[model samples]
Target: MMRKTLIIALGTGLAVTPVAARERQITPYIEVAQVLTADLTNDDVLTYTTLAAGIDANVQTRRVQVQASYRYERRIGYDDRLADADIHSGLARAAVRVAAPLTIEGGALATRTRSDIRGAAPGVLQGNVANISQLYAIYAGPTFGSHIGPVGVSGGYRFGYTKVQAPSIVSPITGERRDVFDDSRSQQAQASLNLKSGTVLPVGITLSGAWVRDDASQLAQVYEGKYGRLDVLYPVLPTLALTAGVGYENIEISRRDALFDAAGQAVVNAQGRFQIDPNGQRRIDYNFDGLYYDAGVVWRPNQRTQLEVHAGERYGSFSAVGSFTYQASKTVAVRVSGYDGIQTFGRQLQTSLTEIPTAFNPGTNQLGQNFNGCVFGAQGGAAGNCLNSALQSVSTSAFRSRGVDAVISVTRGRTNFGLGAGYANRRYLASNAGPGIIIEGLEDESYYLQGYINHQLDTRTSIDANVFANYFLSGFGPQVGVYNIGATTTLNRRFGRFNAFGSVGIYNFGQDQQRSITSIQALLGGRYSF
Candidate 1:
């Protein structure tokens, strides 16, 4: 399958000629909006006004690429119950070719999500500081690739840091409050040697290895992984090829034990989590070491279309992976990708930042911030997998996740349309040896679908609408699940360099028969781009 990490994608960058007539813009704009929100489930009402200024930039040159969307909002509430808030959300990534064979790449992401699965919805999440949390992640790395005769040598090293600001959240299932993800530091190093076909006995050969580490502050936990793989490629036809690989991996996760009192009860800290003892005995959470293998097929009949499918044995089990991509100019795009790997809350957010399109028309919610877990692309609307599953719940445990995402988008005439769907299931890994024993054998699953439409009524007027539904099933029981649904539309008109828009949206959340929260919100705003 087509797999590329920051180490591979940044260092071994794809070479493309700079577009002569690209749509590049660096627009700085300020917006002031009056908002009204009413609770549908309850009888509460809120009136507020937000003052925000942000920048949306997309710039690409022969050797540099960058895209960013950021907003800072200060909300003034008319009622004391409707508290004021400061909200921030943004995503940015950049790559630069420092030399002919050296590349530097980095990205930063900030998002707001629910502290618990039972929190307020993303759209109507205003004034709910207890249930809302903000997360930040940043990573930078350099990759070096050079050719020594017929052999290709590539290597890279990366460092990442992630932090989350969470408030006190109480669980309804057990009425227990605990700490979620606080912070973590990640590091990765990789190197590879490649020999092209016909230069190495008519068969392509590649030997690659990597080492990864993550240090988390929750329980003073640590994750270490080492893997090496040798791959072979043989062409059976001009457009078809067979590929196989065998690898050995050693992965381990460990954490310190909690301090226990005289009665054999774990001592609780101020955050409701167990008190971690620095000098206590450390215990293994998960350990795996074995050989893995996979065989796959690659098909490419044209420049705009390619398909790759593979089946393999990995993580001590059987697995399947594949990718299909089609892009025709800036009008049409189709993509389907699959993944099966170990993931953490921080790593998942970091990886999602790498998938954002460098050139895109940023989409925003009623409050002028991008919706949770979704990113717009150059293909009309959202043209890539949504990151909803990655930001859903703030579970700090490492887990094995398997998922698939597909998007088909097209722009024709003065209308743009797109459809996207994604599914993910994560089985958490925690041993019964320490404080982690509380969350052993847990699982979480999710599926989501989203659709968007944009039509021009005139040269200066347009209407944009989108609808989304996301369902999550927790591991607490077979029938325990939460549903998130929302729809929003905006009517916009442009006059010179100034634009005016109004939007309305409704958000609904249902968790089994225990509780439900529903709200409707509206906004009227204008922005001046400079």
Candidate 2:
């Protein structure tokens, strides 16, 4: 990893280079920041500090330029002193303007993260190992313009190779053991063109298209998707106008192998699996498919007001959503949105989205099959034999939901404040098994609401408060509600430049599931820029 001092030192040297070019100049800069955090939970004491720094430089010469950057960060404090950092990412671009006004540039990306802290809970983890999606990429872009009509085109493409380490855990039922599946990698590319009517049409248009793919062994292979968009803008008067657009997308998943562990076992011995058949590889079998389309409109009567409405639907999945927003002033806005669809509710998905289910993970799902301890059937035979029976019982149904949101704020020079609220209700049906027959699971509904506000006392002082709460109503389960409140203040600039600040906040949550927890945390940090 590249340290801040090293990067800054290098930049300083590069900036002082005696380049005898009148049209070329080198710009270099660096930023360093550190944070100290503390946990105030009654049962445990957790403390930590993080330090981060980055160095960037840009050299512009005539019609060509180059830019590069490097960054490093460390996490220290609490029960461990470990650090994480990104070595360095460097890129150089060369472009020449042609008589037709065309230019092109290409670059590369290389970054990785390493940690030495132990694993724990979310918001409380002390390690960077939890995130292993690290890798490199190559990218390029081109732009063209000419007298060959009144149109211009610009586009870019990028391909990357990433390494990901899935969490080491088994599905608790079918006893399917977890193992390194594949070296996952994803690809994305995009292009767009703009049209202008210098002496003809009074409006302009832009068209764009994009494609992406993510491959992860038998799990998420064939996750390739494509998208397209068209945008139009028209001016009714000098300061008034209208805008509209439409978009479409498609995504699909491929079939793959499924792994299963021996009965009563959660993990297969590394040595045993390798020797069992010398060719025995685990696999999950299922397909996932879907697509989506959307259309939107925007109207701006004047400078201080605007209105937007959007609608979309997903085919095969039988789902649709609509939303609208109105902004009356600089600090006040309200939005309403709703949806009716079937959403995959679990983390470990088993089959294609088209295959919906009633009870979660019908029989022995990916998670269940991996966790061999639970008995999914009465066969009492081999563990893998009972997985099919479990999946056969899965079911699916249509779900509908509606929600409304609003925001208000007051601001004057150095002081600013705002509050917002939102509410939503979602209902869906599920299926469950009975003594001698399968029973239809009742429809379930949940409601959620949240709000927040903040104010600046002066150029060097500020305070903010916020709250989030939600309630769930289900037919098979009791009514449940959860809420949390928090506030923080800074004696220095809220998020100053080259300054330090400290803050403290608390949160509490309760649910009908008999689970309750409360937590408070404090933190202080400082930054320096050049």
Candidate 3:
């Protein structure tokens, strides 16, 4: 179909091929699983069977490379109240090098996630359409870098698209329908010129300009930002440098008014979103233009360790950002990153997809279901496991988000362990004169911790274990806070080209005081791979 081809072409054009071993693999597989789930709070039990088939591929050539995974699933159950049979979950990226210094890079992701922050936790809400939504995002662009004599020039332009599919959700407090994100288009462009130290002068000088914009269909929202900066780098030692940059930035976000009938009542569309007025005037929601500057230090004593830290001011607030990566030994790696920015749910998803490493080990459950909330990758700066954090509540209003995430991986003999943790805070921004006024001044905060361990029982058998805990605070709905905790373990054995697995998990979710719901599930499954 047209959709399948677009994913391939765009993924190839936007991927950055990392230095890796010579690997080319294409695996097609099928699986059948029996599942039994119980809801302790409501004393309800459901049993089902799922049949799934999928392909996993990685192909690398001299001029082209690609990595992708796709699957189709069907659920058979007597109770189909929440059995969403169509579940798509995967991440892909590829690249094609047309010239020595020029390449097209891109990535794509498809998954289902929660649409509202106030919805029940996903730990036990599988296939619940009221709280779940399907998402698809793809991005690709061309990048080129070359030196004209002593001056180095580089530039890039990227186009991104995101779509969300689900019905409108009703507020628990007001019992009224509200709009969620529908889709968005984003564009980013950057160009820079650099002159290294000692080649033309005693110090290095660089000039760069960048622009980014996002247009969302819901309420016809638009956000545009532009900035130009001049940076100076002074070498303090062979492996260390002090850097500073100054720039001017302009940013604005605008949206059109929601439609209203002659009776002065807001109009609601069939999909639960508010209708937009065709004659509505676009009103500015946020506007800021001023100086931007930062000072930073870069340290790289060896190829295995690197660190960059910066402190600056933006949008009339003090800002701090940094990233660190360290390869302790052949079996240990650590990475940490801090970020501050304003973004909508759509933009956040696209940025997270682009950051996912081109090389990764797909995370799956005992039922062979992907989107286990995270992706595991090799040691590097791009090896962020923050997709789990980015998969939070999706709202129509744009918000200023701040967060920091850290990941650590270790391997010891026959066992491997990984840990990841993060915190995020969002303060919503809404137009006072438009439909967005309802969500103004709303705030939400989240903290998450996750850990996993896997042990090889033998040559063909292993056990995988994972545990997670999260706490969330929201001011958008009647419920003030919620906490979710869960643990799962799977035992696997392989026989030639066939594999079998069994898993058990217990999840608990609590909202408002001690009002809690508990879910327990067990699964048995087998797969044959060719």
Candidate 4:
């Protein structure tokens, strides 16, 4: 089941309308701005004027939804560091109920971003430097489910493809630029059956299983896994339920060269050379098989509050999951969630897609909803907001991560405010001794905090402000920790369909025990929307 939120019109004042009754809308806008920027570290100042044109369009109905944004900017001034480019960022998701028991859904996204601004482990990339990158991803699947005399059955197959384009890096040996990229194709199939006993019995039973495979071309990595679980639930009360479950999972990795000799002897490849097997295939590095069980409680005292908590043992390790959401009032809401899981990087993306339904906001693009601070601070350009670093690719390391996130938002007559914080820690399962290893695997932790406020000063004027900070730590790495802090403020005035805005921002980025780089930017622009 998926949850849907009502979309609210932003910037433009409009009443919320049901998707089924609303017509498609498209707005074309253009902005001419003068931008002045300075970097404190190099004491360099650059001034430029830019002309940008973009379009925003959205269509929503009972069976389909689409949203997209595209902008092209041309810079005219004396600045060797700036480049004129086209920026495309958007997400489109659609689901069609083909029949009573069948539904098909799919989504696609394209993004232009920078590596360093994305929160990847410091040693994950070759030079560990932030550079521009582009990502294109798409997934589609069909689900079939229906009630058959109190027994519900459903199954689906999802196929996904991801392509990443990263900036070229200079080769150490040749001193020439070379393209390094990551691309993967993956597929997942899952099925589940559940039986609910009405007044005749107090218990319900559910059985589910899933299989996944991923092939990453550039990294020469392949992963496959199988998982199964059986759950039993009892309704202790109308608002409370008890649950118990048992699960088993098996994971396998292929195309990985071993670090030892063939005779089971100790052989350390100091230079990180690859050793091929007799079958002309890379040796396996890691495998896992485990059985786990857990007990939990789901409590929903009322419509405004709900909480779920569970704990158990898996693979001889402790595991847990929990979440709480409270609609404190008509104007306030809060959510807290935490989870610990062992999964491959590809599977992580799949799981995130499942969670999107709960967080989806039609008013904003998919990236904005997922990486709020980045989209908010990088309103004018991608380079200004590196907060997307948290969503970086970690396919190089199969790992277990535990993380928690909390957010609260409030809305008043003319004001809106929000605050959020998150933390995550990851431990790699595979050893970092093989060839193509940029840096040894290490425990990595990251933290994020952001706050934002928007206020409508008058019928034709508004103001927006936001501040954010991010910190990352990794053990046994040259770049042990890196931190970033930034703040931005904007004021806008509207005259009919034309608007004028001014924004200023300050940012600081620093590596562990190193001198930080500080930058300041200001922009004044006018836009017309029609």
Positional deviation of residue 360's Cα in model 2 after best superposition, in angstroms: 40
Question: Across residues 43-69, which tens digit of lDDT does each residue of candidate 3 receive?
Answer: 888888878888888766667766787
List the candidate 2 regions with Cα displacement exceeding 4 Å.
1-42, 46-155, 158-184, 190-210, 217-220, 226-250, 264-313, 317-411, 416-485, 493-500, 509-512, 524-530
What are the clashing pairs of model 1? none
Write candidate 4's Cα lDDT for 111-211 as tens digits. 54333222322211111234445556677777778777778887787788877565433221223221133667878787777888463467988888877
lDDT of 4 at 114: 35
Best by lDDT, which number? 1
| Model with the higher TM-score, candidate 2 or 3 | 3
lDDT of 1 by residue, 436-510 (tens): 244667777888888788888999999989888888777743346778788889999999989999999887777
TM-score attained by model 3 = 0.90
User: Each model's TM-score?
Assistant: 0.91, 0.46, 0.90, 0.78
Q: What would the per-residue lDDT of candidate 2 be over residues 150-266, giving only the tens digit for each residue?
A: 665544333333332233332212223212233334454555666752345777676767666555432233445566776666666654445555555564433232233465232
- Candidate 4 stretches greater than 4 Å from native: 1-23, 49-51, 70-77, 83-86, 99-101, 112-129, 168-181, 197-200, 256-280, 328-332, 357-395, 433-441
Clashing pairs in 3: 12-94, 13-104, 13-105, 13-106, 14-105, 14-106, 15-105, 15-106
Backbone clashes per model, in order?
0, 22, 8, 7
**Local distance difference test scores for all models:** 0.73, 0.35, 0.72, 0.57
